[model samples]
Each structure stands twice: as C-alpha cells, then as structure tokens.
Target: MTVQHEPDNWRKSSRSQNGSACVEVGSFGDGAAIRDTKDRAAGYFTADRDQWSAFVAAIKGGRFDA
Candidate 1:
C-alpha cells in the first residue's frame, strides 16, 4: 500500500559529507519517510515498518558498502 507522508523531525545520516548528496529520515505512523537533503521539495519515499527494519539491518551489516 502506498502511504503519503509529510516530512518533519528529520534526522540526517551521520555519514553524510559536507558537499555530497545525503538523505534524512522522519518517523510517521507505523513507518518512516525518507527525503533527499539536496532537494527535499522534490520527493520522498515511505517504507512500512518491516521494510524499514530490514533496510536498517542491511546497512548495519554493510550490505551496501563499497
């Protein structure tokens, strides 16, 4: 199901560099919303709770590290 969310209370990634693209996330009902730091007005992605948890776990496990 697609859920609409308004961005607020965003926390930025600590790994973000000063002059690089970044993202911020905010909590919503039973899920979370993500937005680009460079163009927040452009758009965002909302993930359900389970999906969000798994995504976080993958990050912790270095699944996307290069």
Candidate 2:
C-alpha cells in the first residue's frame, strides 16, 4: 500500500547530527510514516501505530542493536 507522508510534522531523530543521514517520522491517524529526510519526495514506509510503538520500544531496549 502507498503511504502518505506529512512533512510538516515529521521529526528527526535527536541523534541526527547536522541534518545528515537523518530519518524523519510523522504520524497519520492510526499509523506512522517514516522516510529519509534528505529525500522525502522519494516516498516512505508506513506502519501501524502499535507496531511503531513496539519498534521504538525494541530500539530503546537494545533488542535490535548489535
């Protein structure tokens, strides 16, 4: 399915430095959109809100970090 990205509310990761190599995320109702900040027009990836939350939690818990 095609994802609709709202650039206006997209937030960059705090760990992003100098706006380089940064990803941006925006919430759209029950889902979230994620895309490369440097190429927003290229399109985005979308996930259910709950899945997004779980993904974030996993990242914070280092479940996906090597």
Name the top TM-score candidate: 1
Q: Give the least accurate 10-residue stretch of model 1, judged by summed lDDT.
A: 2-11
lDDT of each: 0.85, 0.82
Compared with the true structure, what per-residue lDDT tens digits does model 2 show for residues 2-51?
76546468888787798558888888768788898688779888888899
Deviation from native of the Cα of residue 58 in model 1, angstroms: 0.4
Clashing pairs in 1: none
Q: What's the lDDT for residue 45 in model 1?
A: 87
Q: Residue 45 lDDT in model 2?
A: 86
- Candidate 1's TM-score reads 0.80
TM-score of each: 0.80, 0.76
Residue pairs whose backbone atoms clash in candidate 2: none
lDDT of 2: 0.82
